[model samples]
Target: MPGETAPVGLTLALGRLRALGAKGLRVALPIAGHPLGLSGPPEFNARALDAGEAVIVTGVALGLVPEVFQAGPEGDVHSEVVWRSVPVREAPPADVPSLGEAERELAEALREATEVLSRLNVAGAGPAAQAALEAYRARAGRGREVLAPGYPPRALRVLELAQRVGALIEIAHGAGAGAGEHGAAVSASEIAARAEALRPVERTARRAQVAAYNAYVEELERGGS
Candidate 1:
């Protein structure tokens, strides 16, 4: 679904806030066209700011961070303006999937990707590729660790997907490198070429993660409805 524009993440964030009984929360965002000093028409800028604010508000509600803030001009003119919120309150149960199930699924995906890279023997690919593979292994190990309870299911799913994205990046970086039986090093050009060849794998993994996240969001939306 290219160019799809469902604000599922933001919607879930707001839903979480409401479920947790948050009231009158105020969030500040850059006035549209003046983001970091750029300028655009007031109407366009306002819409941009509104969209950005939705994301920040959602993140805060999801307990992604303690809070979100912005320090910029007020109304695209004043020099000093701020928007902030109180710390995130506890999330209420929405009866989504269990954290353990999410962790297992993510671990399985990472394992499959790891096996693919291992069979490719990317360590012989080049120093950079080897380093990337090692990093991926470490990250995958961390991602497979046990999950604790109490977080919202949607938030947990997003976190798992975030970890999967990181692992996929490393996999992409190490895509086309393998050492010979003699343990010879690979050329940089060959490694780059191999990475290009493996682009499809990376792309597929990326799409799968995105689809999973979107599906979770859709489920949340349906439940809310």
Candidate 2:
């Protein structure tokens, strides 16, 4: 393995720490590597940090460094472990919230946004709809345009649909191993697999939600007439 050293390589490091009288110290391991040159150290460190566990990341020069800091609260040391990185060639999405509990949150955001929109008020609904639509698009593999500008009211409608189905799919996809223990930030491959597993449920939910919303709106408009 290009990045995987013998367990002894790391075990010796731990032994050094112990010999140095390091106590209550937590050690993280980079379990795997990818063909893209990315490694698992960062994710491992993130899990450790999230658990409020104290860690001193080592193993740089082997493409693993802990220079990056994901700052913590007062008196707590915070940092990021980078096993590998590529320079940004393009801007990433504005945000990517967790899709683990996304469906439940999406459902709530949609309902609240819908209620606001139904009352012909859209100010607070923007943020709400944005959250729901983003979660939906994440699972459905659609882009962020589902929550784009120039369509605040319609975006709320779209959000409602996404919430109903996006959450269903999110829940249907079981948690990956170590997900709970790792604070839900696992390896890239694990995250990708979880998202892929959600696609079908998300798609089905999307279609049903759209059709149902359109029908209900049409009926509402007819009643108003």
- Which lDDT values do the candidates have, in the order given? 0.42, 0.37
TM-score winner: 1
TM-score of each: 0.35, 0.21
Taking the tens digit of each residue's C-alpha lDDT, what string does model 1 give over 13-62?
45656665533232222333323111233443344355453112222332
Model 1 scores a TM of 0.35
Cα lDDT over the full model 2: 0.37
Each model's total of backbone clashes = 2, 1
TM-score of 2: 0.21
Error of 1 at 104 (Å): 14
RMSD of each: 13.1, 20.5
Shift of residue 158 alpha carbon in model 2, Å? 14
